[model samples]
Target: MELWFTGTNAGMPIADRNVTSIVLRLAETRGEFWMFDCGEATQHRLLRTPLRITRLEKLFVTHLHGDHVFGIPGLLSSRSSLGATAPLQIYGPSGIRELIDSWMGITETHLGYPLSVCENTEGIVFEDGDYSVRCAKLDHRIECYGYRVEEKPRAGALLVDRLERAGIPPGPLYGQLKSGLDVELKDGRIIRSADVRGPAIPGRIVAVLGDTRPCAGAVRLSERADVLVHEATFGGNLADKAELYGHSTAEQAALTAREAGVSRLLLTHFSSRYGAEDIAELVQEARTLHPNTDAAVELTPYAIARARNES
Candidate 1:
């Protein structure tokens, strides 16, 4: 899996960065990418990267903040114009559906694809065989949320050599064995799949949070995740100011990742007052607590490698 930072600035746009937006590009995409947030001019940001709005299957809005959702209408319309016929599912806090409904209604924007808006609360909002998504309320000015994506564990690799050594040919019998069924051989012997297969491979976990301060919800949502994408909107020296504004400093974000025992911490949503040079200080502060930490750069794809134990 790869994480693409489309926007990483806080409050306003900087010369090099836009507001808060992150796209979770699955390496094994079933024809869709999951977007964490769509900030203002996010479609324009996608134009700079290899990502496309048409390929986005789901949009998870952290809050109704303009910097987090102002691009919804534009992105939707652009996808329609691009001849995307797939349905789009949007999940967010209450009033999100109404907000988009009003925006589209006022602008008289027409869309060809079907849109499904879901106002989410704390719990497992989405689940399927491949993945499950859960959300939790976070400390912010409004009803903000954090999401956790957990991929399902996969069956172990079939032991082709072991089966061949046992005089089992690779045919329909291999299929039955792979499906965890015992295959009866012509010699009146039974072969078990589990006896020959390797250990099951653990799935990956990803946590993505919107604008929020250091809180338990953040830790709960990000616990032991392979990648924890937390907003670090202030510098270490500005801890008091960050709390007053319901934001977290880079150091605090690092602390959260450490407490959650996450493998990697990606700090983003930096205040616009800081320039590119200032980001070094933020990242350094985070590294003081969590060594596996990095400040996210806009349009860069950060690869999420599987944890050692998971592998």
Candidate 2:
């Protein structure tokens, strides 16, 4: 899986960054993506990237802030124009349905595809055969939430050579064996899949959090994640200001990452107050606390690889 930061700034648009938005490419799908936030002009940002608008399958809104949701109406309208017929699911805190309905109704925008909105309470908001999304309340001014996307473990590769050594010819029974099912041969000999199949391949976990102060919920959601995407809206020295504004600094994000034992930490949601000169310091500050921290650069894609199991 990969993560692309569509926008990274906090309040206003900066020279280099936009607002808060992230794009995650879904695994085992047809070039589809799960959008984390739809900040203003987010669809416009997608045009500059390789992510296709038609391939967007879902959108997860963290809060009801204008910077985090002002682009929803425009994006949905644009999607219809782009000929997206597949249903789209949107998950967020309460009032999300009203927000969309009010804008769409006022503007008379009718979506060609159906849209599904979830209340996004605490628990598993979405789950399928491949992945499950868990939500946790964050300490933001509004009812913001953090999401943990856990990719399900995939089955190990089938041991064709082992099957051949056992004199088992390839057929539908081979499919059963690959699925961890025991198969009985025509001669009445039973073959156990455990003896032939390799160990299961572990899946990767990614946690993307919304705007909030450093809180326990963020840490819990990001526990042992392959990648933890958190916000660093202020400098490390601005602890008091960060808390008052319901935001986090680079140092706080790094501490959360270290505590959660995440493999990598991606800091984002930069405030426009910090100029380009402050970029290096912001990243360095996090790195000093957690060696694996990196600031999210706009339109940059970071790859999350699966952890290898020992033999």
TM-score for each prediction?
A: 0.96, 0.96
Instruction: State the lDDT of candidate 1 residue by residue for 1-311, as single tens digits.
Output: 88999899988787888988899887664757899888889999999888777898999999988889888888999999999999999999999999999999999998999999999979999999988999999999999999999988777778999998998887998888877888889999989889878778888899999888899999999999999999988998999999998999999999999999999999999988898789889999999999989889888889878655754
Q: lDDT of candidate 1?
A: 0.90
Query: Relative to the true structure, how large is the alpha-carbon lDDT of every model?
Result: 0.90, 0.90
Error of 2 at 310 (Å): 6.9
Error of 2 at 61 (Å): 0.5
Question: Which pairs clash (backbone N, Cα, C closer than 3 Å) in model 2?
Answer: none
Looking at candidate 2, the ten consecutive residues that score lowest on lDDT are: 302-311
lDDT of 1 at 25: 82
Backbone clashes under 3 angstroms, per model: 0, 0
